[model samples]
Target: MTATTTTLRVGTRGSALALAQSGQVADWLSSTVGVPAELVRVRTEGDVDRGPLATIGGTGVFVTGVRARLLSGEVDVVVHSLKDLPTAAADGIALAAVPRREDPADVLCARDGLTLAELPDGARVGTGSPRRAAQLRAARPDLDVRAVRGNVDTRLGMVADGTLDAVVLAAAGLARIGREDAVTERFTEDVMLPAPGQGALAVECRLADRHTGPYASALARLDDPVSRAEVRAERSLLGALEAGCSAPVGARAHSDGVRLTLTGLVIAPDGRRQVRGEISGRAADAALLGRRLAQRLFDDGAAALLGDLPLRAAAAAGGG
Candidate 1:
């Protein structure tokens, strides 16, 4: 159906967090572009699998299934947790926009409103992300870091039930689902840098619709330049490192309209060895800045730290 005559079908994973974010996008399209938009839930492999993310294909697991729906013309647009998107671009699909971003910091949901530092020695903390596990271990080597998987509520329930003393989650995810009050403490970048593109939403459509369709204008207007630049820089570093989304890698970028600053980190899964680097350049050079920083990280021995990861990449000429 033509976008002009029919409602814009926005495809999304059926998870509560996904629906909340996708619903926001759909509502925006309806209100801003005057096009009726509908939510079309798509079940993904990641949703069905209870296995650890890295073992089951990491970053692309949550994305591939929903993207297939977009490619098959079943939906006009798809919304994704930007962190779940692979650095590789999908053929025939366009990342039409990255709307305004949420706070990308990760937070600790601990019992007794305790902050990270307040946790007693040997405290049990659960997280599904290797990056978070590494950083958490690094920050408090005495504490126990456990791998746990489930939806946000399930993870949080573990804490409520005393199964886990605490859990680490994306601040944005908690915010989107109206559970911000559960956060006991927000980790600073120095303590726990976030995953690249963690707090953003990706709006994608078929490549052809990007420049010539009823949705084109709305997509263009939806893109926030600063947010896009920030994520581009972060994702570029991830791509340059050749690391999968579930790798023990963390990056954060900020663009203040004119200039951009990016930081990249690579830590061993065990949190013993790590390398971190930072770079700044023109905001327009976000991607270049990322590659440059990644190269710096490699030069600082980041590669050795990644050797044991499930997904490892040899160091290459950065900014190639």
Candidate 2:
């Protein structure tokens, strides 16, 4: 379709964060690509079910419905929170772009501007990620960690209403929805590692249109090479481990002009055991770097921590 005759429909979940990000994508397409675009809200099972993510199929639950719409030609493009996307590629879909990523750190939103270290012992902390729960427990074993599910405001409300003393949330999610003021402290990577592709947005289109078309032109203009390389390395680690996004696994990657460095972490559900490894190589070797790091962590005892768990068996009942 020609740019003049086509109005691109960008698919996204209806959540506040999803809409906010999708709206940004739409605006970018209009301003940069000169292709007028509209947001198409897709209802996903993840948004409907209040059950724990692991119990309902983990990583892809939030993405499956939106993807179906894309495959069916109901939408010309789809924007997804990269971390929610599965490491396994879908057959006919192409990840056309990864825009510049947001901050991937986890943040602590406490009741009284309290930082993580200042929270009293036995204080109740809420989160919806197995990775966060495990890391938090490792950092503060005396605190009472609770599993939680809901939108950002709903989870933050737990702290406001005394249901939880603090809630750990993605820094990127808060930033996207203009809710960063709710954050009491931003956890450094030393304290908590983000999930693979966390803080990045994935722009997808049908494989057939990926190489040719106005959609392809828009996608090419939207993709950021740096962000693409970083996520490729991180997601590669997740894929190599064969762990769902909800698994108690964490990965982060950084690129220094000449080389890409990746770090992989695996923690036992109980937080009593852990393994971490790092690898660096040319950014062009991002995928291989991730696999190498994963193998290193496995040799260092991560395999035992992960082997006993089921594919989507998130030790903590949570959502992210």
Candidate 3:
């Protein structure tokens, strides 16, 4: 396909990490597709609200506005952190691509370059994610886990200024913002499983533009099949469980061309109880494998554990 002369407008949130990620995509589109690409910053409710994510809304708050612009023909494309996207399908938007994934593990940004195990008893850890909080408390029952809100720099600043002993954040976000130096320890999957679809980017376009759009072919070229398959399994599990992105649930999946392995976990908010399960099958059965594993967890009492938590739709609508 020949490159078009028209400029493509990529919608994105104005946050530093969002800008960094979207800027990378725009550059790639310009260079690889020989088309001019510009970023259009779109403010989101998540950015404007200073309250807790749980109270304000869980997933989709950051994405809803950008998606609205895309649907309204205000932008040609939008980039999102895949983990922040809800498991439910959007009516008019198509996930055009999932580029190669980054390290999906959670990292600890701690004081004095201390690791998780090196922290002293009663050390305070800050995180806004229930998954991270539960994992931290599960691993270190003595540590003080506190809820924190803000951007990556703000959270890291707290640790640097001695307001908190440590904070947990996605390594991919730090790397995207060129702040990897803030990470003191990268937790392995065994120690800390990542949220579903973590470390992946979703490039979305209007469903009607898949074939006739000038940039459709270019965006399609960015899709990585292996990454797509892995995240599909992970998100499928989340969908089957009916949990939001911020739920106290963790999942990770890996595919080696032929076989796919998935690990799923549910941890109590208090970290007093936990359940985990793993399953492997043909890579072609990714979605089925995810659902089956979730069913296994449910059979092991995952439903009972999650029954009391706020549903994704309710949380996203600020009903929580």
Candidate 4:
């Protein structure tokens, strides 16, 4: 019997940060499975369009093309920032592993040195994320929140060049590419719980490939069980709320030995109404934690605030 020689194809975006992240996985594969590797770059619609993300839709816009490559056998595996993936898995697609998370908090970079507390009345704050925009508005109702969309450097440039007073971004992404010093202060969970799966990375492969199994298992070595449970709980909360990724929902889950605690927040667009909650349960019962928290919030009239928007517009926009 002859063994088939294999060099796994890893698909990723062409951006500097995307390549760096994919490189981390490829390096891990080579060391663990002793297999040669190659990177297949794909251009996502998100990359081609310099328009506002709101116009293009949110979440998965950066991932769909690479996911297609995975399904088509063009690439054996794909790398993604976990937040870019929806809580619901697509048909024929599954996530094999979620690596240990990076920092899961939004950061404020202010040129005027105004902290979230110090921003003057009617101050202009910039952010591409509805999650951040809503939360910032909820936190400081006095300031003016506006939309600004682009990659990290582009958004940061708004602050650097004095186009905006300050902007919010994921702390993990900044740290990933050596931009940590740009973070003025990391928002506390009460102020800005991160989006579901914000700081994690998901490496995916086809369901039953024997060769890729070894490499996938190698990547799974980096998975943090506690982070996995916490992120899973947070994703479940978002899913139950039926909130689009653009919805102003932020959450964090943590575990202490046998108990898992989930904290959730929902804020209105104008920053006037904010609802927050926390529930503790057995670490093994993530779904229960999410369900109970959502139910309690619903009893508190969360559903009244969440109107059923056109699902068609949402799906077309992106399952964000």
Evaluation by TM-score, superior candidate among 1 and 2:
1
Every model's TM-score: 0.96, 0.95, 0.96, 0.90
Ranking by TM-score: 3, 1, 2, 4
Report, for all candidates in order, the number of backbone clashes: 0, 0, 0, 1
In order, the Cα lDDT scores of the candidates are 0.90, 0.88, 0.89, 0.77
| Residue 3 error, candidate 3, Å | 1.5
TM-score: which is higher, 3 or 4?
A: 3
Q: Write the per-residue lDDT of candidate 1 for residues 1-320, one digit (tens) a residue.
A: 23376888999999899999999999988777776889999998888998888777785788988989999999999999999988887899999999999999999999999999999999999999999999998999999999998889999999999999999999999999999999999999999999999999999999999999788888888999999999999999998888888888999998898999998899988888899989999999999999999899989998788766655432121111
Which pairs clash in the backbone of model 4? 245-320
Off by over 4 Å in 2: 312-320
Error of 4 at 79 (Å): 1.2
Candidate 1, residue 58: lDDT: 84
Deviation in Å, model 1, residue 23 alpha carbon: 0.4
Tens-digit lDDT track of model 3 for 158-215: 9999999999999999999999998999999988999999999999999998777887
Error of 4 at 240 (Å): 1.0
Worst ten in a row by lDDT for model 1:
311-320
| C-alpha lDDT (0 to 100) for residue 85 of candidate 1 | 88
